[model samples]
Target chain A: MKTVYVCSNTVTGIYSAIYDAWKARKGEEECSVALRGAVETELFCEYVEVEETVHKAQAVEALICRHLGREAYWDIYHAVLAADTGKGDAILGAMLAAKTIPDSRRIMEHLSHPKVEKVFELSRSVIGEAHFLKGAVRFRELAGGVLYARISPKAQVLTCLAPHFADRLPLENWMIYDRVHRMFVIHEAKKRWILVQDEFLDPERLPDLTEEEKEYTKLWKGFVHAVSVESRENLKLQRQHLPLRFRPDMVEYM
Target chain B: MSSSESMTTYTYEGIPQYMPQGAGGLRPSMFQKLNILADAAKYDVACTSSGTARSNDGTGMGSCERSGICHSYSADGRCISLLKILFTNECIYDCKYCINRRSNDVIRTSFTPDEVCTLTIEFYRRNYIEGLFLSSGILRSPDYTMELIYAAIYKLRKEYNFQGYIHVKAIPGASKELIQKVGFLADRMSVNLELPTAESLKLLAPHKTRKNILTPMRLVQNRMAENKQELALYRNAPGFVPAGQSTQMIIGATPETDFQIMQVAQSLYQRFELKRVFYSAFIHVNEDSLLPARTDEGPPLLREHRLYQADWLLRYYHFRAEELLSEENPNFNVLFDPKCNWALKHLGQFPVEINRADYKMLLRVPGLGYKSAVRIVKARRVGTLDFSDLKKIGVVLKRAMYFITCNGKMLYPTKLEEDYIARNLLSAGEKLPGEVVNMGYHQLSLFDDVGFSGKMQQYM
Candidate 1:
């Protein structure tokens, strides 16, 4: 009978489930990982609930980094952060397939393997969305002078974008709220950034815009309008590059 | 006349004293100046913010990314990477095609150096722009305008500690000293090659000489060479135009052949080592005898797009200008892109074996991008890749299938004839330009006229 390890849908929970499956010495065909809420009941399968912990997650991270190498570890980390519920199984399969390969560090380059390919695809998409959000994330100055931005990215990209913004704006107090994940990346002036989860922001109690913010918004809108060539107006091409989904958060479109 | 009567009445004037008030005297607000200056600067097409990657030293407020970032797109579908605006619209030159020609009656305004700094910092902090793209009209002289640009960028870099990307225009006739000073503060510097040939420059822009423009370009090239050596000797020598220089020419303005324009661009890339060469389709901004006649047809955007396609071929695909175009075939085909057109003409090179072909040959395939070509080489090292693997590797098989062979077998039993492949490729849902799609297939000729297409009038 196949064994299924159930865990919450998160980086830590998935890694802990992987640790439990690995500790039981289960082969690729003998074990599978499933998310807690997205689990499907299977007949002739022994289901086990994983006791998630920070230590288990750290052990799994270190084990992958030590055996699969840093680059493959990076890919697996990004795959875990992806929105796909089957990412835990794909990651575990790739790890198990790595042991059969001549060099475990070259697992990512083994694109012919099904599980490795799935991990590669998921990592690429998560990285792609994070790269786009690095540019598309727009900040608005509130009345208190804190730079606040809101993004609704599919992946858990708050961790990926927080360091970039913190390094880019070191002296400014800034916070980015991921509306989809209900997570916040808060950074104080000249301080390290911290991630806060399970937080809710009331839309009605949003901060008021500063005077300078309104003035700059008007100037930016006018500039965006005037910079476009009158003879070569192509809204279709604009929509192709910047999709309508990202237009609501962008100030120029607003 | 009594002195008291003259002072009180002030009615003894043949021409009244020039009173510069209202629009001329009162300074335009920040909003008005940004609109006027950005509007005047819209004719310039280079808005790229790539080629420089720097991190904030924890002292400055901004950083640069290697691939660059597009904060937004304008209505014309161009990427808004930088806050592209002119320092001033005041000019002493009367170029025929310029909207801000000294003869044209348009509202002119200039921004102070401090205003430029404030706008850059505020916009960058809000993630509204990647950086500042500062160009200017000759306010009084080339050197004078260059000094103003230098002052603004210097203030932005030093006082404001702005470490973001800065692309500045090197005034054509400006002195070498001023250009060098400005280059040290900017990430990229460019001197506009307004026309492709000297004859066209003489016919259109009387004030600008080709020799005057090339002199600054050659100066920047030599200085960058020297800067490279200095940086090699000393690790922190304060780089000069680290992203290198780029230039733009007004396409369709001077009746230059596509072959001639591309040859010039190829030479610039090879000789001057430019980072990019932007081609602006000639928009009818002014109606002068020297310029093209104003018509209902809009800018020759399709022709411009074809030229850019050929430009990419030259840069990335290791293609030469003579290979893409010749004296006989002076322009690109409206039906096919430059690469596909090249491939169709050279059918003997087709059915390239995916497992045995070299990297350069893989790049010549129609649907194989540089990235996909690289993946094929890497993935083929592990195992023999079949058709399905190529599709998973992101190759557009609908187009590449006709050109490539997997394990000595074509994906489909396809004919090697040129006309057959062309017809099949067209039916495979290749997305052509809007104008080309609207016009029926029969209307396109093998060598279509690149300029003044009658089909473009409908776009108006």
Candidate 2:
């Protein structure tokens, strides 16, 4: 029998834990698997704790992103996080299994595997949002070398969102904080990355809100409003394209 | 004031792609300039990252995932996810078809390196685009024009530390050194073939030559190869063009057939490792007498779409140019997509037992998109995927049903006849605007006053 550790939060967090689990597996210690964000009773094996480390997290990220391939990395990340089980060991085992198989997208082992379904569904939603938000989301520079913004997604999609930002803004001094999850991704490519999770997010805490932000905010809002023509006041079409839910956060919608 | 900047749609009424000034020549706000440029640029369907190798090196600033990003969509019904704009609309080369040609009498403008860097960072921050897609008409000299473009890209990537996707166009006559410099900074670089054939280029665009155009393209391809080789040898070779290089060919411009265009595209990919080959449909702009007159009916937009489909097939589906078209047939079928049409010709290959068909065979099936082809591989391993299961997963059976079989059973009862199926599929889409216009759209327009249609056809 083996003890399984579960990590059921973000892709980075799970990846960080994967680094730990892989190391343990290589050792003489017994290893087992479970999904994150899960709670249950331990039968026999002693539970061991692994703290998140940047070095371990970096290795997992590099392995998935560099060695594994782009699409697979996305699929595994989504699948790993979407599974409701907090048995981190199980998820990690499944992820490791996925890596070995050339064709990783085998839906799920079981039909009702929440993580597998979540991975598929969330990836789709995140991709769609990323495409649209590539236009809708606005970013501004905050002090402390952080680029800050908020994304309101329909499907729980903070995990899938970071890679796009990470890929595009890797070298840039930036941070994308998911307010819904109270998590933030800090990326300074080739420099240092700090991912803050399960912590308080104070919007005002981000530095560097100068006059430029104020002016651009007003300007962006005006541009969006100006583009909406009264001649074609098709609220249905407008709402179809830009939903009421997203408008609260977006300046153009406002 | 530029017509594009003033009015809504580009009806080609006044100078298109120009920033409209209000009243007595007032400067438009930066936001308004972007709207105009974004709207103007939405039509250029060139910013793509597919059919290329992935970024394996850890040394590059960033990489372009196989799935492309559309920073934003402009009014012209294309992605504006990139900062698509001209370095300067002030062109000395009087390409008759260009909106920004010297003789067009339009308001000219240029953006400095600093200005471009600021806009890209700003738009990128707001999540407006992935990066910059910068192109320019020949300004001053080719080298000089190229220098400004390189300066801006380098400034954005180097100075601002911007790792966003930058797709820059290399001026035909630009120096090899300059092209290499930008190649290092840009994720993707392209030199527009502009016209399909050398003949059309000579006739319509007398200033540009085949040698001038292909030289820079060849140079970039060589440098990219060298970079990859170096990576293998040293594992620390500096990145050249991480996204690789892609080129554009203006469709419907010349008398070149889809076969000829595909051959060029195939050679570019084989010779240069091209990421993509964009096919921009020609829309007439001038009254260049040397050009064949295209009637008001316009260049074949459907043909252009089909060419793109054919291009995709050539690049990914492992379909060869000879397999797709011949010198006799030349053009793609106006109705069915190239993949479906190709499969219909080779019916013997299908019904190969989905359980056993290889990746290449599965890719050949109609309705199996890039993803579906990939999906079929995984699903079959769990168990032999039946026709019903394929549909449940994602395959569009409407088209594939005609081509494929489930466990040696054809879906339909009737005998398979390629001709019969093709005709039905021919009348499938809208009547293709006008079918019986036997002559090419250009031939009929010559007698009628040489209108905009004639000029754009040269580049098409």
Candidate 3:
């Protein structure tokens, strides 16, 4: 019988499904995996919903750490954080390949392997977006005296970007809200930053910029207007470097 | 006056605005001033922010990372919008090649010290830029311009308390005391060499002599060296141009050969310890009979790209300029890159055993960059690295295959003949920039050379 295992949309939940699937060993072609919110059911397939059990997830984690080493685990973990709907199944397929193929710990480097290639591609996108946002994220001084910045990244990158800002502006009170994910990485002056989830942060309810903020924004807009060389103006190249989606939040573009 | 007096933003029209004082007695809007100055300053190509590691103190609002952050790239695939504007576009000299020459009918304006600091700090706070790249035309004299630059940087550091990277141009004939003062506050300083040769400099820029440019460069170099010694003794001795100095030479404007340019660059690196030598593909702005006529192909961008590639080979690949090109071979081959051309010419260096060659030897091979060379050394230690392992380590086997051997075995029994490898390299041409390829000037490749496709499929 062709069986489809569905699980929650998270790393731990996916790991639990992988654990159950491995224990069954119903052959690679017969068993399939999908995330909870995703429509991935095949016709005539027996569907099984896997509960996210801590023990089951830990069991899969231990198996991966033992066989593929720590680096492979990180590779799988980062790739899972990608916005791809098929990420859960991609990791499951890669894990199964690791079990079957000898010396498959180097699978991430193998572009020929479909599942491995998918994971590698997704990991690069997630990492690349995070790196770009490090330079792109703009901070505005809010009325309450804390610095505030908002980003609507496609990937779930708040966790990836938090540590960098924490180390950078340790003594300042700041908050970087991931508007798409409805999560915030808040850092108090001289204190460690913490991640908070609140889906109710309305776009209309953002605080007004301080007067000092207004002057700086005016200055920045003036500078940006002045800096670009009119003779060699390449709007196409500028679009490639800083995409249009990033324009709405950027003060200069506004 | 206290430094704070010069630190305040230059106020105009009853509000604090950093607009330049007009030499032409014209009060242009801030926007207009920016447009004119930026247009004049655009020819300078050094928009780099690398090689500084300044962290923001608890009080400051910004930090400078050592690796350099490229906040944005321009239309020409160059990094831009680092507030790369001139303090003024007013000039004292009429260099034939310069857009900001006194003889040109362009608007003349100047920025006060306060205006520059305000712009730098504000833009930096918004993360729109990494830092500032300030260059200016000589307003009244070189000393006057250099003093204004010093005051601007001093206010930016002391008054604004901004600890970000700042790269300033040291005016060729600026006073030593003034240049030293600015050097302490600025991260990097550059003196434009203008042209490769003294003859070319005199021919184009009649007013500015070669000696005037080199004198300030040598002073900055010696002071930077002396500062290094003091830094070892005193922890906070204040670094002198902590990011080091660089210079730019205008290509295609003058009649200097690629060999002459490379030799000059090599000497600058060896003698003055310059951080970089920028080669700007000269875009014809002013209509001058003395300058090279604008050809159908526009700028010599391909030639500039080739020189930069050769520069990298000199810096990292341990290849000398003499080995790449001699008097007879003055120009680089347009068909292949410097490394591939070198390898093809000296076929005796072929089939370097990948597992046996040292790091420097591996670097000499085409397609093996510094990162890949290091990875090869690290990976081979654990086990024997076969062709599959080399592919996994991210080596570009297309070029490297002809040069490297796996366990003393060639990937395919490749011949060491120059024509054979050259044909393969041509057939497997990497994607070129549209600007470089669209000119229809490059020699057409013989991709349909018989049996090469069959040979390539055998490896696959």
Candidate 4:
């Protein structure tokens, strides 16, 4: 009979499930991980509820960093943040497969392994979305002088975008809200950034924009319209690159 | 026409404006100036913000990404990476193709250094642009125009502490000292080639000579080489054009073959050490007899697209221009891309075994991008990759199926003949350009030699 460790759909929850499954000392075929809501009950299978904790997640993170190396650990970390429910099981399977190999750190390069490939694909997708959101994230100046941006990314990408903007706008107070994930990445001027999760902020309730902000928005829209060549207009190609999903928040589109 | 009188009347939003028009001229507001300058600069076509990655240094309010970022895409589908604009539209040269020629009666205005700085910083703060792309028309002289541009960027860098990407144009015939000073402040610098050949330039732009343009390009190239050594010696040495330099040529303006244009691009990459060579399809903005006759056919966007595809091959795919086009075949095939056309022409190299082929060989496969080719090589080392695995690796197997064999087996029962494969690839839903598709397949047979027999044929 196979044993499935069930946990919530989060980095901490997934890592804690991996921790419990690892401590079971069962063979790779005997144990698996699944998200709490996404798990389908299998016949003659032992389902264990993982007691998720910060310490367990930290221990597993350190274990992977020490054994599988930082590069593989990074892929696993991003895979856990992916939207796919299979990501937790895939990551756990990849980790188990790594132990069988002579060199565990090179597990990501074993792309032919189905579990490892799943993790690689998931990590690539999460990073790809994060990279796109880095540029697509737009900041509007509020009446209070803080720069606020809202992005409804597919993955929980607030963590990835915060450091990039924090480095780019070190002197300016800025905050980015992930509407889909209901999280916030807040950074004060001349200070480090912090990620706040489970924040319920209504999308329609953003503060009023500054007078300068409105003027600049109008100017930016005009500039976008002016810069395009009238003869070479191709809405299909523009949609291909910019995509329709990111248009709602963009000032030029608005 | 005095500068003092124009300045007082052009005030807006408490910021003093600089107007270059004579008395009785309407003082265009900031909105109008941005519209005019941005519209004028749109034709230059080098808006990339890549090549340098610098953090904000904890003092400034900007940083650069090595891969660059697109803040927005215009309706024309061009990436809005930089706030591309002209410092002024006032010109002394009557270039035949230019909209802002000296003979033309256009609104002539200049952005003061402060105005340029404020726009860049404010726009950058809103994440509307990656940085600034400052080009200008000749105001009195090349040196004078270059000095005005230098003043704006110098303030943006030193006083405003803007650490963002800045791409500036090195004005042709500007003093070498002034050009050198501007190079230190810009991340990337370019001198427009204007036209592919000297004869076309002479006919189109009477004031710009090949020597005048290449001189400043050579100056930046030499300075960048020296800056590399200085940075090697002193870690914190101020760099000159750290993102390197690029140049652009106006295609279809003159009677230059695609082969001739590509040869010029190849030499620029090899000899001049240019980072990029942009090809702008000549749009008829001015009515000049010397220019190509205005037709219902818009800009030669398809041709420009092909050149860009070939340009990517030159830079990334380890391909030479000669491999892509020749005097016998001066233009790219309308039906297939450069790589697919090359593969079809040389079918003897077909059916490369995925399990045994090397990275370079995989890159030549019809539908294998560099990324997927790399992934195939890595993944195959761990396990054999079949057709399904290739699809999983992001290879467009619909096209690659005709060219590749996985584990000594083709994806489908297909002939190795070029005509058979080309027809199959066409039916595989390869999205042809709208112009080609709209022309209808029956008409395509008559137009098979589209580039070889059209207006471009006269040049050949």
Question: DockQ (Cα-based) per candidate?
Answer: 0.80, 0.16, 0.32, 0.81
Question: How well does candidate 3 match the true structure, expressed as C-alpha RMSD?
Answer: 7.0
lDDT of 4 by residue, A72-102 (tens): 9989888888999898899999999999999
Worst 10 residues of 3 chain A by lDDT: A223-232
- Per-residue CA lDDT of candidate 2, range A1-254, in tens? 56555444555566666777677653323554444435465777655555666677679867767655676566555455442444244445455555555665542432234434445554455567655654455567564545677766543455455655665555566666666667776677655556677788776665766577766666544433433323223456455655567655565444
Considering DockQ, which of the candidate structures 3 and 4 is the better prediction for this target?
Answer: 4
Global lDDT of each candidate: 0.88, 0.63, 0.78, 0.87
What alpha-carbon RMSD in Å does predicted model 4 have with respect to the real structure? Answer: 3.8
Task: Tell me how candidate 2 scores on lDDT.
Answer: 0.63
Best by DockQ: 4
lDDT of 4 at B66: 97
Q: Candidate 1, overall lDDT?
A: 0.88
Q: What is the lDDT for A132 in model 2?
A: 62
By DockQ: ranked, best first: 4, 1, 3, 2
For residues B170-277, what per-residue lDDT tens digits would candidate 3 score against the true structure? 999888988998999999999999999999999899999999999999999999999999999999899999999999999878766788889999999999999999
How many pairs of residues collide in model 4?
0
Task: Compose the digit string of candidate 4's lDDT tens values, residues B151-208.
Answer: 8898899999999999999999999999999999999999999999999999999999
- Cα-based TM-score, every candidate: 0.94, 0.69, 0.80, 0.93
Model 1 pairs in collision? none
Q: For residue B216, what is the lDDT in candidate 1?
A: 91
